[model samples]
Target: MLHYLLTLAIFFAFFAVEAWGLNLQFGLTGILDFTYITFVAIGAYFAGVAAMTPSTNGGMGGSYIFGWQLPFPLSPVIGGIAAAMLGVVVGIIGLRRLRSDYLAIVTVSVGQIVWMVIGNATPLFNGWDGIVGVPQPYNSVMNLSTNNYEWPFLGISVIVAAIIFWLVRSLTESPYGRILRAIREDENVAAALGKNVFRYRMSAFVIGAFIAGISGALQIEYIGAWNPSGWTTLETFIVWAAMLVGGRGNNRGMLLGAFLVPVLFTEATRWITIPAHPLLMEAIRGMAIGLLMVLAVRFRPQGVIPERKRVFPLTTIPGLKEDVANGHTAQG
Candidate 1:
């Protein structure tokens, strides 16, 4: 039971990180990034390749690049950088002029392209079989039992989640966050106000991708392996659903949704005995999630925890008091 609880905690940590990233993109900046999982895959593959011993070094049989066999801690950082670079490329191509439905289609197409490339290109991280045998951080130094090591790793995961939460909360409460909200509400108005809308959107995309990459690295480290099968486009939707159910713009809500949707809902499905084919069970799961999404949209569109309204001070502008006293409304 203790071990199970620890594992669940680790999973929650990873989901929290992913949800935070998605909240930044979809909730805060309104990117609607349907291909978000691609960045996570990038991080996982990059970190896996970095940590794995090269075939040239008589390690494994897979052909891949830069098998430096670097330390585990460095893998996530490098992976994050790689994912950020990809985010830039993606943003340049997708966010140039596309909006709404078109933007979503392009992002999904990009995700498909990435998935095909990784699944088919055997030279790159062993293709569909994916990378394996990723080492844990400080494994050698710790030299502890497997169960003992997991506890410390769980602690690390929790710490990382908290730090990410703090960083994202700070970003969302800053002036930049306000600009993002403005852009989300009305891009034209933000642009007319001399805000570089595209730049801000791209920055948000890249930052979110970086966070996703970090979570991906952490995920691969925990699992000790990664394959193409694990990062399908549907994974992106799962995170999106969590955001919707949790309260899009609320960080705490996102955290709760992460646990509720992915952790609890998924785990609950495991115990049910569906008297149907295995494939039917999968279909049932999808249908259940779809129904939940529909209910969320129809009844509680603002999510379980709605975003709080920001209160601006009446004296935000100088001389507003005198204008109000004279029964005159300020004009924009």
Candidate 2:
């Protein structure tokens, strides 16, 4: 049971990073970005292809482009850049002015196409068989076996998560993050205010994709496999649910969302009165997530941990902004 709980913790923690990335893109930027998981898939595929051995397992493909077999840390970085580059390429075409719903349709369609291409093209991505027995980080040079000393690799993941969380927190607090929020609120107003809305949007979108790649890299390394079957578009909805439940636009809320939704759900399953059935359990999980999203958006749109508002001092406020900025503040 302890091991099971530990596994749950690690799994949710990996997705917490995904939630953070998606929050930055969708929650903070007001962009749908339903292709979020595609970037994760890219990272997973890139990392898997690059790190995997040229071996065959269960007839899965491991014939990746980078035959050099780089270090684990370096390989994920490459995957992340690849995701970002792909994001840029897609965004240039997809982000052209279109209605919100139209944009979602286009991007989501692109996602499906990308998945199909990877599934059908064996030379490019080894087709549907996917990659297996991918190498883990630092396993070779560290002289540690995957069979033993799992703690060391686990510890490495925890450290990487910490670093990523800290970086995201810092970025959200920086001016760049504020610009993103500005664009989200009113792109027209932000542009009128001299903010390059499109550029800023592209920046957030690409960076979010990069971070997603990191999450994918970590997950593939931990599991030692990557398959097209695992990273469906529904995966993006899961991250969205986490972001909304935890509190959109709040970094800590993303982590809390990750834990409360998946980690706690696994724990709560112990009280299940019905016998376990795979299809039924999956349905229940989906319904639960959908209900959670509805409840969160309808009842508590701000989330469990609301974004902290910055209070500006009086005196220098704009047009009655003094009172508004000060303690007795109302509207301008």
Candidate 3:
């Protein structure tokens, strides 16, 4: 039971990281970037394959590619870099042409292609098996001797989450974040004003992807394995749901939504007693998520904790765009 509890904590930390990444892209930038999970999968696969021992990584007996047995601590770095590289490549193509909805479709297709390739490619990713036995971060440092390594896991998870939050918070509040908002509001206007809209958008996209990759890498470490099912397109929707319910443009709301919606709902499943049809719980949960999203959009669009708008008192600096907390409001 303690193990389960510890695992649940790790799960909370995991979604929190994922939500942070998503909040940067969709919440702040309004890019939709539905293919977000592909970057995560990239990180997980790279981290997994890199960490796997030669004996179990690939091949029937002992065959591994660049088998370094690198410590788990380094996996996130490797995974994040891999994910960001992949994100850059994708951003070049997709970010070139598309708006909110259309952009989502292209991103979704890209995510599916990644999934299909990873799921089908046997040699590259060991097929469906996915390299297992990936080590947890700092198991050696903690020097604990039991499966109850949950404490250290939780500690590391918190540390990583804090660092990421600090980094993202700094970024979002900086001048770069202002550019993202401008682009989100009116790309044409931004472009008209001699703003390198595409360049800034690409940078935002790549940074968001890197954050998502870090989350994915950390998740693989926590779970001790990285598999094809590690990242799914549907999973992105779940995080989106949390962001919507919590507040699209608010950090507090993002964190609240990440914990309250997905993790809480998953925990709530234990208490739900449905007689006849055991799988009903799953369906019911899905419906609940769908209903929440609809209600959020219709009734509570601002979310539980609405975003606070920044009020500028007639002090318009060069390149400073007007913005309401919610929608894009940049002037050409």
Maximum-lDDT candidate: 1
Worst 10 residues of 3 by lDDT: 57-66
**Top candidate (TM-score):** 1
Displacement of residue 252 (Cα, Å) in model 1 is 1.0
- The parts of candidate 2 lying over 4 Å away from their true place are 55-63, 141-148, 266-276, 312-332
Model 1 stretches with alpha carbons more than 4 Å out: 56-61, 271-276, 312-332
Better candidate by TM-score, 1 or 2: 1
Roughly what TM-score does model 2 have, to 2 decimal places? 0.87
Off by over 4 Å in 3: 55-66, 140-147, 267-278, 311-332
TM-scores, all candidates, are 0.90, 0.87, 0.86
- lDDT digits (tens) for residues 1-332 of candidate 3: 78767777777777777777887787778888877778877887677666666554444532324445678768788888889898888887778874667667778888888888877776667656666666666675777754668888788888888888897788777777777777878888878988887787778788888888888888777676666765775667778888889888677787888788878876536567687888788678878888888988899998998876877653365533344443355553
> Tens digits of per-residue lDDT for model 2 on 16-101?
88888888887778778888899998988787777766545335454445534667788788778888888897777766663345
- Report every candidate's CA lDDT: 0.84, 0.78, 0.76
RMSD in Å for all candidates: 3.3, 4.0, 5.8
Candidate 1, residue 286: Cα displacement in angstroms equals 2.2
